[model samples]
Target: MFAPMDSTEIFWVATICVLLAVELATLGLTTIWFVGGALIALAAYECGAGMPLQLILFTCV
Candidate 1:
């Protein structure tokens, strides 16, 4: 599990950044969809989602 880096906003942002980087690198819309998912988790995290729920929200986008 990830430790120390406990802030969900940071995690979501980092994930979106990486996703965007991947999208930009390959210009693949696949990563763009995942970026959307990360945004959803960001919103849910703002609403106080737990890690499990946040992960699920990320997966569902």
Candidate 2:
């Protein structure tokens, strides 16, 4: 059986997607760092991090 994805992971993935879309549209570096942060948070979530810890990891990145 497969475990369902957590909301936090979904949110992080969504954020990363949106940021990437914006980056693509603008062709600018702005928001790319945020995408990096979101990717890091997504990784944290995949590693079984809690929401609070994920947020902290995102902020740090």
What lDDT score belongs to each candidate, Candidate 1 first?
0.85, 0.87
| Candidate of highest TM-score | 1
Writing each residue's lDDT as its tens digit, candidate 1 over 1-61 gives 8555456688889999999999999986788989998998888877877889978977886
Candidate 2 displacement at residue 29 in angstroms: 0.5
Alpha-carbon shift of residue 21 in model 2 (angstroms): 0.7
Off by over 4 Å in 2: 1-3
Score every model by TM-score: 0.81, 0.81
The residue pairs found clashing in candidate 1 are: none
lDDT of 2: 0.87
